[model samples]
Target: MTLIPKSHPRAKSLLIREKLVSGFDNGLVAKEGLLAQGRGEAFDYLLGEKTNQAAKRAIKAAAAQLLQAQKPVISVNGNVAALCPKEIIRLSKQIKAKLEVNLFYTNEKRKQAIIKTLKKNGVKEILGTNSANSTKLPGIDSARRIVDKDGIFAADVVVVPLEDGDRTMALRNAGKTVITFDLNPLSRTSQTANITIVDNVTRAIELLISESKKLTKRNEKSLEKIISDFDNKKNLTENVIQIKNNLTRRARVA
Candidate 1:
């Protein structure tokens, strides 16, 4: 947590960029992740750096779904590992879930680097790089296709933060319940997820963990109700409207 001074409107955004650059230098974030951060930041800026009501509902539903899962797994990528490794670990432990690494880059070195970073953040049991004990998502032909036997492959629920489009589709097509955090409400990843939280990972992960703790004492039927009542398309549509409204307000202010 560097204390970057926020003197300008873009100050916080610049701080985010600096953090991503630092992650890259630390061998924790991929080069493309830097670009992804910038793209997400644009959306975040439009959304006024706050989580919307729809996203909050989605996070609540996500927690309930994870609680009801037989095997809940959190899908980790370089961007997610760089942004919120400790928070990811905390959410996984809070919901009694597994952590599995799934990268779009498909690099052995980057995979090891992400694993090392997660280990640095107190992750003990990581599931990646063991093809002997691996399985693939049916119809998926990407770096994310190869999941560990005991990881996403076996899990009934998966939380994919900073997810990719094709893999999210593959996971749903494989009949796995998918929850995702994508800053862009219109992304294919957001559209494909059963519950999509359209917020920054830093903010959304902590909220999700908090929500999970509160919902743990509830009954299974109640939890299933929360999951069953979620509407991803409607949620996404509302967020899109929110973003548009924000932009319209900004235009008027300017």
Candidate 2:
């Protein structure tokens, strides 16, 4: 007898999609986010739904950066908010970071829905609703370019999970330390980030929160050392090698 009915790859993938649909119905995820999740699911299926070793190191580094941040802000887009709203809130509380709702596709109702969803997840204060004080991220033409005045604008460190390329690049250019959770090592978001965890956002976020909790007791010197020691290029290369190795093994098994 099967312990988990969706244990098979095909079935399990479908189940993940179902959860996104559930999030969508509950106003936790936007329509564009639903489509983005579908694309991410396809990529996850290819990587065997496992977090690689390099990604693990990256997660720890990301946590260190968060712990050291004097003014850290977690950028909550549709995909991240839907996938791990509660976890995001927990992380914010843990690191004492601000939770800001920043989306590529923005609208009044969707922003309200996201805020409502976050509140339902027990978040008391959510930022990014006031577009009256807006700042633009250069080179990104979408609504994602628009950041709240007091949110991402003033942050020393920003955690942008599952982000698009242009925003990541723009943020980096503006001199803010960026931490990203992108699956593909080759993606611009991963490459541009100060620290990139090339793992599933859900898994990476939880690990980041866990690491941050332990790192909270550590001093700024230690945390900064973690960031200083990290080499994004080297890590990205290792992730690429891991992907190649996994593909080869999968082909052999087939």
User: Could you tally the backbone clashes for each prediction?
Assistant: 0, 0
In model 2, the clashing pairs are none
Q: Give the candidate number with the greatest lDDT.
A: 1
Candidate 1, residue 51: Cα displacement in angstroms equals 0.9
Cα error of candidate 1 at position 142, Å: 1.7
* C-alpha TM-scores of all predictions: 0.95, 0.91
117-222, model 1: which lDDT tens digit per residue?
A: 8899898899976879887778777877889999998889999988889998998998999999999999999988899999998888999999999999999999
lDDT of every model, 2 decimals: 0.88, 0.82
